[model samples]
Target: MNLTAPARRARRAALLVPALLGAAVVAFLAQRPLGGHRAGWNGWVGTVNGIVFLAAAALPVAVLAVWALARRRRAAGAEPGWARRSALAEVGTLYGTAPWVWMILLPGVDPGGPRRRVNLVPLHDVAEIVAAGPPATAAAQIVGNMLVFAALGFLLPVRFAAFASVWRVLALGAACSVLVEAAQYALRLDRVSSVDDVLLNAGGAALAALAARRWWRRA
Candidate 1:
């Protein structure tokens, strides 16, 4: 079923306006310091919670900006569908990926107090997480690791023909994970840089690519 141009624009506006409104509300609320104890806005904003909150608040606006730019391109005679998909894929990938990466890179409070850790053995971290008590924590850890690259996997193929293959996404995810792990180790971030993390990240990317296969195949 094909939508007329006006119908499409109306549909887009319906979605976009609500999203922009929600983002504005979030941004407004985020200005207030958490727990209501004013530790100065900047101080609160430096914490992990603050960082995540700010990122979340900014994401919708960023996507909206990208979408408007895509519309401009379409007005200049670019293919409308291509412009829309490209904008969504590009902004979605970056916005979805960056926050996780930022969280991963944040230095541990006692980074200097402990030696940097590395787990070269495959599956070691996974095994430990599973065996560790508190199923919720374990699940969160596993899911978080997967999500770190999920957006990239799901969107890359949609935007670029070169990344359409699941194998290629898997390899790229693993390579990117390796660089992140290397960064953690080199920077003495007091985090365990593990092979299992690389495995999980890659696996997650591959799975996400599979989920998006129908769309990319059409592309």
Candidate 2:
């Protein structure tokens, strides 16, 4: 029997991504660190908030795009059937989270109080939470967050298939959100660390995975 397509592609992509990311990272680090609070153009990975957003939004698409291009140009030797929808789902889930990540990260709401915890997590009242606004609304932050994971759900089962379990994938996305919250809290970045995000983010992924599974069955 011929070698498994996914296993072959994974092995190859694994080899390729490090080189691409490493080159970008090295190029990022080579620049000089300039003066001031949040200084200089050279500081790539300058802010954890932006970095988190970039990872969530851009890296998934970038890596997948590179993989697709390679698959298409396979030098008459190695090739694999590449699915566009699966990749799009994965990319959308990730990119959708970017706005929220940036919103939290950027120093916007000035906590005028002397106390460390000021409670600026948007929906303060139970009544407001029930009202439900647009995805970008502070009250509806969960919408974008969930949509992304839903995409993740579809992509993981349809594309990645065997690597990450549906539950595990949900957990992982939740974990990343937790990590971001922790990093922001610890670093004292321009954001608050909320346990609520972990819940919302995970919920999004679970829903996404459910949708994805259903789609696969239909396909």
Best of the candidates, TM-score:
1
lDDT of 2 by residue, 1-219 (tens): 576879877987888678667745743543324233355432334444345434544554566674575555465444333444444445555554554555455442453333334343543532344566543474455565555445555566655656246677678678877776776665555455665666667777777677666544232
Error of 1 at 100 (Å): 0.5
Please give the distance, in angstroms, between residue 78's alpha carbon in candidate 1 and its true position after superposition: 1.8
Q: Which has the greatest lDDT?
A: 1
Candidate 1 clash total? 0
Whole-model lDDT, candidate 2?
Answer: 0.55
Error of 2 at 146 (Å): 2.4
Off by over 4 Å in 2: 1-70, 73-80, 83-100, 111-128, 131-139, 214-219
Against the correct fold, how does model 1 do in TM-score? 0.85
